[model samples]
Target: MSSNAHSFYYGGKFLSKVTDLVRSEIEPIIAARGDEFVDIEYVKEKSQNYLRIYVDKDQPGGIDIDEIAALSEEVSEKLDSLEPDPLPDPYVLELSSPGVERPIKNAKDWEKANGEYIHVGLYQKIDGKKMFEGTLKSYNDEEIELEIKIKTRRKTLTIPRKLIANARFAIEF
Candidate 1:
């Protein structure tokens, strides 16, 4: 079979094993490449398993397909060689750039993103609302200062950083 066909067939059955492989090795590779490993998950659907990897750097365009492909190839080789089960069925391998909408995954990520606009949602209503989009001005030990603009008005709202249920860099277009 062609290399493409073989790879396509093999990319459907390794998740936990591959995750373990990447969670241990791929982070270092990403770090060395000046990027951060945001997340790794096994996407299982019926008879196929998809390995999903998310990596980010301080700004947009920090990650690319080459990085993902290199990581995927390395991880695949490592798993193919080290697995106790060796050839445990097949699986699909995917490496992707975690675009602008990627979630802020760690403190370092947040710190690097300071001064950028972000979209954040709260678990419960705060000051009668549960969502806020603003410039991430500053962050202290407890809360984050957001420069929010509502219509023709502007205000700096202090929100506990921990209270952010989810946050992501907003697209500036």
Candidate 2:
């Protein structure tokens, strides 16, 4: 499953430095436009380097391509003007929305996901199940409540926050 959680290779000091530098340089510009910065990442794939920036609107309906294009240009210009380029290798910069099945990484993500359908993966089995798909009822620091279907009946499952290995929005067919 796709997730916003960075892989182990991306958690090193070098990647952390690049992420910090990019966030510090671009956050103010993004905030000035009244948009929320979801995340930023630097990764190497197929021998090529990539820098991706995820953004979303504070309101509903999400961001559009035009908005992404405008922000991309501004951020590109900002990076280009940095006195000493932080990245040692050339990388492609990408700006876009976190898609429908976006990973629930923080409080804001959980807040936005309330009442939405989601898939939760546990580090250990809960009720003999390691994974669950349900309508997110509520979430707080201690736990998350979901309304799940089982044999034609709906049940509420209270999952401890510590047990969740991953949680993300799920599209229902």
Candidate 3:
């Protein structure tokens, strides 16, 4: 076991800062193009480092390939031109659309996911269960209302937004 597991490492902190800078720099460009850049996540596994960008559009499912390619090229150029340079090491940069099972992270995400089947994990149990799989009826910044069909009746359950541990599109065949 590593004794440094619980400690904050400088390299990790620096990487986080770099990712933040990249996210901030790219958000405006994406927004101006009438799209949203969801998240900038750094993945370090084994001996490889990956900078993954998740983006979304108003329509459901994945975004267009041209949009992804364009954003990737633009971001690459900007990052390469940074004065002090954000990243210290070589890494693989991947820009792509968030797919069907994409996570619902914010109010806009939840709103966009409305009317779709979703699986949600709650921080606390509700009706003896901490998980729910149902159709998202509606959602705002404060709460999400899911319509769960049980028997012959449909029930709408209101869940506080912050109580959601995780949520993602539930694919049904």
Q: By TM-score, who's the top model here?
A: 2
The whole-model C-alpha lDDT of candidate 1 against the native structure comes to 0.70
Off by over 4 Å in 2: 1-15
Best by lDDT: 2
TM-score of each: 0.72, 0.84, 0.76
lDDT of 2 by residue, 1-173 (tens): 22123322222334335677778889999999988898887877798878899998877788888999999999999989876677657989989898888889899889988999999999999999999999999999999999999988999999999999989899966
- lDDT against the true structure, per candidate, is 0.70, 0.85, 0.77
Candidate 1 lDDT by residue in tens digits, 65-168: 77777777776776667535333567676667667677765787689669999888898788899999888899876888889888879899999977888788
Worst 10 residues of 1 by lDDT: 1-10
Q: In model 2, what is the error at residue 77, expressed in angstroms?
A: 1.3
Error of 3 at 95 (Å): 0.4
Question: Could you arrange the candidates by lDDT from highest to lowest?
Answer: 2, 3, 1
Better of 1 and 2 by TM-score: 2
- Give candidate 3's error at residue 148 in angstroms: 2.8
TM-score of 1: 0.72
